[model samples]
Target: MRRLIAVALAVVLLVAGCTRNSDGAADVQVGGDPGASPTLRFRAPLTVTEPSSTVVWAGTGSALVEGKPVLIDYWLENAETGAVVAESYTTSPKPYLLTKESLGTDLFAALRGQRVGARIVEVSPASAARGMTFPTVIVMDVLATRAEGDPVPARPGMPIVTLAADGAPTITPTTTTPPTDLTVVPLIKGTGDQVPTGAEVTIQYTEVDWATGAVVDSTWSTGLPVSFSLAGLGAWSQGLVEQTVGSQVMVVVPPSFGLGGPAGSELQSATLVFVVDILAATKPTAPVSPPVTIAPSTAPSSSPTS
Candidate 1:
């Protein structure tokens, strides 16, 4: 299993390096019948008819994937080796939040809106293709793509805020401030990062009911971060992305928390104060890759009148 994972990940890095962006995330490289170079391949067996964002490959003019935040089922096969690389099958689409580039789980990688259904076979064990080592072929399929996300903006650096889930405490931002409520204190001031559209984050906070003038739920998260997303998540954590992570937060929620258990159901609405630590944080920033442009096509014709 590890062997397959290693090979698949290697091919992905190779494929990514061979590709670059032009103009920005707005304009990406796509398919065209142009001069072939040792650096790139103009043809791809798998393709996307239409592209969503600037995040597209330069190889084929067609879209390789779809949706802003895409999820895919990917598989890698050795082009020459004829080996199956890796496999991931789940109902919920594994988002290919392929920001600038991905971090971990290289073996199972995907672009937005497209999933490599199954990575089957490996051709090049480490041979140079166009001077770069790339698996001759990779097998993938798109599982799902839509206008859904974790509800975070495209930001980097700083901290991020991810909402909570059911059986857990619920928090909401009030239109006005409550004097008897807790206030978050930030060490520094920055715009903050963007949480993955569907990331579960833990928070340490305090909650005080205005009516009681007493601290109610002033406890930290027992579990890792609560799982939530802007795409599929409901009720809780809906509008959290509006605020930046690392910054202090003041919110209101029910006094009782389920903690994933049946007990602790004292539902009371009050302003909760928190200094949230956005796990897997991201900040708004620009892509580092340079933009590219293709030679413009020209028509040739001439006529003489006598």
Candidate 2:
């Protein structure tokens, strides 16, 4: 298990993206929006090949566009063999969705400037840490894009404070949401290696954006005595939580929280790597039972010992 986690970490560090499957759709985590993915004025050397490569022209990509929202539909397949690995198709179909300004992630930056039904793109130089760079190929399809002022979808897992957009609360409505936060730490010495859900744990952590290698937040739990709820709940509330409490994990909280997007305008995903030690455990008290005493039979004193 530790080995698998270590490998996963290696993959994340090299790939520069986060992946999540939602309702048969994949949310490919990308870097911050820099102003509409750079218009591919020229082809990039460090890139991946997508199915749309042939149909598209050779041009440089755009950084996400500021203010304007980018709406798109994507499909991922092996570039070399056309084998489908992931796709984002909605049976109901909600057309024209923009990349929210408030959120941050890698996709925003990489996918900017790309218009809907425009064409697919490929990226190479398989990030330094992506050990298995030879994954055949990746294909993405762009359906359409919309300018800013378009209605943005309300993302989940964030608190919606009824305040003005401005921090003043009363003057300009603001929603006090948690900043994009995450930590990757190593457990201290003598700290049990396993991260059980019900055990108290400790570790040292550093945080980085899932979309970019930029450090936005970091926190440590050195020798700190803490208990577990086993579900990693109430933990993310405190900045750090183990999905399995012991297993190393990558936690991503995208933009939409008001925090500066990854690399400006790009969506943000906080990826965490945890090496926790069980320091203590919370358990119910055991019940106490009375002890019983035993008596031996007497033989009439044996007549004064003869």
Candidate 3:
């Protein structure tokens, strides 16, 4: 079991995006709004003598840059079998950091210069995609692109916040004493949509123990933001509510509201400091009707994990 898990993880990390499909490309047809999820239809036995891609719809939003996190809704079909291989339209769109190492070869090739809100159709021959016997047809909708949010002014008495060129934050302790009350500081003021309670939010954060000034954890080290719903994050939800996406914030939580326990226990007593950058916010999408369970794809993909 452990070996199987490890192999699966290796596959996910190293080859999630392989070829578009296994066989020769067949006829590919796509129709839908560029801003929303589009429809994918293609005849079986599609033949792609060579790899091909087309932008069915062009969005007016910002163009996507390589190495940035991107959110997308997608559908994959096996042209030979006429099957829905893997899809996110029935569930939720997935987020992927747009790097060659993380995306499938064909997907990365197809989306390099596309703008947010574009709909793309791509066909990959079996020769290009691995582990397939038929050509694959893929349709994708680019939803949003992650950006380094606006820069905010400094606040006195809070931890000093500085950013690397890529938006990762370096937090330094300014004072030895921890605050007794909750302190919310907006380090970078963003212009994006306000984050609502229970919405899924993507953020890069570093946490430290206030009393000892020791680092607890951080997402900055990985260079990828983590996303979660704010429903049960306790003080996190309180501090982040009403903050706009792309804002960098400093949240100081007392034990009672932050960790929840006696006031003096080592774990509960120490004030916690979190330096967070709100990169994006999305609400839970309504589920599509008559949900379809598509078979997992042979192609490598980095769509959002359920």
Instruction: Report lDDT (CA) for all predictions.
Output: 0.29, 0.27, 0.60
lDDT of 3 by residue, 15-132 (tens): 1222333342344556654334555555556545555566666766677778886666667666567676665564445556676656755567667888876776665555422555
> Highest TM-score: which candidate?
3
Q: lDDT tens string, model 2, 1-306?
A: 000001100111112334322232212222222212212211122223221112232223233344542323233333234444333231101112134332223334445565433433333322334333432222234421211121223334322212222111111111344344542222112211233333222222233343344444332211112222333333333333222222222233334332333455443333322222222222212212211111111111100111
Which candidate model has the greater TM-score, 1 or 3? Answer: 3
Give the Å shift of residue 128 in candidate 3: 12
Tell me the number of clashing residue pairs for each predicted model: 52, 66, 16
Pick the winner on lDDT between candidates 2 and 3.
Answer: 3
TM-score of 3: 0.63
Candidate 2 error regions (>4 Å): 1-64, 79-82, 90-110, 123-133, 144-306
**Full-model lDDT, candidate 3:** 0.60
Residues 99-173, candidate 1: write the lDDT tens digits: 323212332233433332222222223433223233433333332221112333512221233344311233333
In candidate 1, which residue ranges exceed 4 Å CA deviation?
A: 1-223, 230-239, 245-271, 279-306
